[model samples]
Target: MSASAKKQSIYEPDQEGLYFPRPPVFSTVAEERQHRRERLAAVCRIFARYKFEYGFAGHVTVRDPEHPGLFWTNPFGMSMSRVKASDMILVDHVGKVVEGTWAVNQAGFVLHSAIHEENPDIIASCHAHTVNGMAWAALGRPLDPITQTACGFFGHQAVITEEAGAVVVERGAGFAVAKAFGDSKVAIHQNHGLFSVGRHSIDEAAWWFIALERACEIQLKAEATGSPLKLVAPEKAAHSAKHLATPFMGWLHFQPIYDWIIRTDPDLVD
Candidate 1:
């Protein structure tokens, strides 16, 4: 290949007739709503696969395309492993279950509702009590740029100290969390666990949550060794984050997981 062809292949491989999968576009709100619901269901199953479950304490939500005030979330009391698209519940900002027969989790409603309400740009949000995430959050500090994977959250992560470890069931508590979130994509609620958001798709939110949990685990394990850890330089970490931590990248990285989920647990969409 010519030099120009090689450069184009590297930078714009999907420019023309390439087979890269892109986020789907829908013609109608109904079609888009169904897509989001299925994706949310898949994310829940993905969380289950990653063992991010803790007696239904976790929640992943995707905003309704037509009705921005509402979102779809896993039913309260349902295991992430068993949640299906049809079992997902539609909830309004006021904590009302507008659709679906199953009840909504109050803690989930308080936090996710405030997040979706306060941030119009956020299309999806995920929060879970994973073992590593909880352990890291207990330290009440943000992850250091110790690895390239950790670099993804170098400047994009926040640590919310207010209401630390408190159960987020009150409206005011939820609002506090959202206020701390501001524009960051990931947050570690002090003494709680991980939270992530997506401005683009549920795939992005889900993937970021998974990535954040893994990063937390890696950092914890590294620190446990007691040797001084080498930190990535600020400039380099920022550059790495710019390219690797984008919403598009998160969505792209999730495609394989989505594919695997559909193939192995096809009933999630039911």
Candidate 2:
């Protein structure tokens, strides 16, 4: 065989390796579900790309805007790197699987359901155990803006200092998490990890992304200075949050980034 032919054979995709490309837009319920599946896959893929997802654990959820009682999440025990839109399962507020083939993970029942049920404005949620996020969570402290990157979380962070042991098993634990977040967009589950709420998948993903990166940066800078860290005043933080919470900013900032990811890896939509 020619050298070029051999090279072509080596580079060609196998039958099972081929993937379908995502459509440019979605216009129906099926298309929307496909979009949600793709969005969930993108969340998982981004986590894996940034090493943000917890192994065999952690979760991200999106509320069905039309069906308030149902949402999509990663199937139990799936690796964040390999999660597909087809792998996502739909579960009701009571934790029963409504649409997908897999069962709801325990943490999904305990953490996401309550957030979705209580907060009508919250359309998507992301939970993860990135090193910096875990460090702050372990310290049992709320995140503080030590840099401009942390500005996104300025006043929207809540510290859930007391998470009941085995929240998934305990009754009302989900509701408790909802209460802690209240109207805030972020929650730090002490000794556990971080949770973010958004008006859409991109919104929540951006919150988690900024919060985790900020936590990591703060910890690194604090260690270098070996001195007490200063935090922006609450009022200032609140003011910044007001601007960050506006839809225009989030869409402008995040949609382009998310669109880039979709364009580069359109198969995630499948």
Number of the top lDDT candidate = 1
lDDT of each residue in 15-97, candidate 2, tens digit only: 45454232245577777766676777887777777788766667888876468678888888878777888888888887888
How far off is residue 135 in model 2, in Å? Answer: 0.8
Residues 102-185 of candidate 1: C-alpha lDDT, one tens digit per residue: 888887779888988889999999999999999999999999999988999979999999789888788888988899998999
Global Cα lDDT for candidate 2 = 0.69
Worst ten-residue run, lDDT, model 2? 2-11
User: Which predicted model would earn the best TM-score?
Assistant: 1
Q: Each candidate's root-mean-square deviation in Å?
A: 2.7, 11.5
